[model samples]
Target: MYRAGIDLGGTNIKAGIVDEQQHIIAEASVPTNVERPYQDIIRDMAELVKTLLKQKGIGETQLKSIGIGSPGTIDAVHGVVLYSNNFGWENVPLTEQLRQYFSCPIAVSNDANCAALGEVKAGAARHAKNAILLTLGTGVGGGIILDGKVFEGAHAGGAELGHTSLICGGEPCTCGRKGCVEAYVSATALIRDAKRAAQQYPESSLNAMCEGDLSHMNGKIPFDAAQDGDTAAEKVVNDYICYLGETITNFVNIFRPDIVLLSGGICNQGKKLTEPLETYIQDKCFGGSKAFIPKVACAVLGNKAGIIGAANLISGKER
Candidate 1:
């Protein structure tokens, strides 16, 4: 039997047909074109899945289940998207709509959680029964997997690791909170701090790297300049590491999972990013060196994690 996974995003709707072995046998995608009506988006999603199955010459009955990774608050038990800022969607009957096209068990979950599940089923955390994944992109998004199953809390809005407060009342977050982990650990936050550093010291190499235009600065500029021994850039890089380190430490103290994975552009820094964080978590976590310190690594599946994980929503079982 095969399962279908759909990754619904603001820009695109992606679908895949995966075999029992967890490998994607076929895939299809369509531009979400968020400007259209919700019905249109759903139609596109349904069509994409149909196209993939057709391309593989697989019958509809061959698909044992279909899973969707949707953004925002999800009522997974009911297959509804409670809210999605990206599409201005609220209380959307996602699974109900899809069932009109495909007759199978459909599961809808937070995209972040699906990503975590994907990593566990086939990616970096495959060997670990419990793991955490933090994606530090435009905003910080994360998922918690406990005992080989996604933990959705009582309300299905749980495990929003990014929105958790990192500072009591520091930077404002997009979620209307003050000093969320997203406010400090996201790539946007890192770039914001880099631009500020560039403006503060006109003589800094960062200023030269961005060519005196702060808009040109990105998450990589600081790390690159720091490696070249630029004091201003080093300070910015160190500060980012400190904030991220402390944040991971706090999570470690709470979950103490088998491993913690970091995703997003900043992870491109490789060990330059994970090494320091490992050292910090080891030093500051509750048990210090005597306790089990989760290994920190970068997410390997990249964009595919969402699709693979979504499919596992039904096929996956708790260990």
Candidate 2:
């Protein structure tokens, strides 16, 4: 039976038809146009799905199920978006609305959870029965998998790992909290620190790399300068690693999952990123000698992960 996955983002609505092997054989996308009404967006989403089936020369009856990955606190069991700050949405009856077009089974889940499930099903965490994923982009997004199943806890509102406290009374977070993991460990946080370092050390390579224009600074600048033996950049990079390492250590000590997967553009740093995180985890995780150290790896599926994972939700226990 064929399954379809829809990745609903504020900027885009992406959908794909997947085979039993978890491969997306047909796919398409459309602009989300958030300025329009929610029903209009949902209409575009349904049209995208129909477009995919038509591309594959299949009828709606041939589609077994559909899954939607949306950004927000999702009530997966009920297929409702409890809340979504990204789209200023609340209590949206997602499945009920989508069911107007398809009678097949449909599931809704948080986008991050879908991505994590995608990794476990067909990507980097394929070999792991339990894993944790952190996408360090504009903000930190997290997903947890246990026993090869996505875990969202009660009401599907759990596993908001990014909002977990990392430092007390430290930097402000978008979540309106102080010193959350997202506040310090995200790519946004990295750039914030890089900009500060550039301003403080005008002679540093980081400053010159950005041509003294703080607005030009980004997450990659520090790592690039550090590689060229820039002291200020090295320190910034090291500190960022420490914060991330500590965050991973906390997860290791708590969940002890088989692996920890890193996602987003920051993972492009390759070994330069995972190595330091591994070293820090090995040294700082609880149980100095006998604890299980989860493998640190990059997510294999890039943007496709959300789509694949969302589709997998049709068969997921949480769904």
Candidate 3:
């Protein structure tokens, strides 16, 4: 049987029909336009699923389940998005709303967790029963998988690894917390540090790369400058890596998963990012020599991970 996976984002709603092999056979997307009422968005999601099924010439009986990867704090047990700052949503019964249009076992989970599940099932760490994925995008998002299952904790509100504190009274975070891992390890954080460095060292190549516009500075600017042998850019890149290394070390020491995967734009750095991070984690993790040390790598699934993982939520079980 196949399953429908919906990746609900503030900008778009992506849905796909994923086969048991975890391949997307039919897929489509629609603008979320979250400014509209929540009901409209839910309706659009159902319609997208229907379109995918029709394109594949499949019927309801051929679909095993529907899974959604939604942002914010999700009460997966009830398929409710408790709160999502991105959507300004609160207490939306997403699963119940979708059921009105599609009759299938529905499951909803935090988008980051779904990405981790996707990686476990078909991407990086596919062979590992325990894995952790960190997505360094606008903010750092994390998903923890244990024993081949997503661990949502007791309230289905845990696994928020980004919010874990990294510094005391350091950079302020959008979450109203100071020195969060997200504040240091996210692409936002990298850009912030890069811009500051460029301003302080006007001679740095990063200034020219960003066209002297601080607002134009991005996560790649510093890395590009560092490759050109700019000391200031190198400092920014090194500092970002140091903070990320510390965060990964903390997670490794605590969970000891089989692998720690890094996702999002930072992964584009390839060995430049992963090599140092792997070294730092190895040097810092407790009992690294005697115990199993988790390997660090870049996640391969990219954007499709959430959709594929969400579709496989039922794991071949029938409703």
In order of appearance, the predictions have TM-scores of 0.97, 0.97, 0.97
Q: What would the TM-score be for candidate 2 when compared with the true structure?
A: 0.97
Q: What global local distance difference test value does model 2 have?
A: 0.90
CA shift of 93, model 3, Å: 0.4
- Judge candidate 2 at residue 23 and give its lDDT: 94
- Inter-residue clash pairs, candidate 2: none
User: Which residue runs of candidate 2 sit more than 4 Å off their true CA positions?
Assistant: none
List the RMSD of every prediction in angstroms.
Answer: 1.2, 1.2, 1.7
lDDT of 3 by residue, 1-319 (tens): 8989999998899998999888989889999999999999999999999988988899989999999999999998888999999999999999999999987899999999889999998899899878999999998889988888887777867999999999968999988989999999999999999998988999999999988898998888899899999999999999998999999989988899999999998888999999999888778888877877788999999878999878877662122
Clashing pairs in 3: none
Give the per-residue lDDT digits (tens) of candidate 1, residues 1-319.
8999999998999999988877899988889998898888998898998999999999999999999999999998898999999899989999999889989899998988898999998899999988999989999888888888888777768888999989969999999989999999999999999989988889889999988788999999999999999999999999999999999998899999999999898889999999999998899999788988999989888878899999989856333
Error of 3 at 172 (Å): 0.5
Lowest summed lDDT across 10 adjacent residues in model 1 is found at: 310-319
| Better candidate number, 1 or 3, judged by lDDT | 1
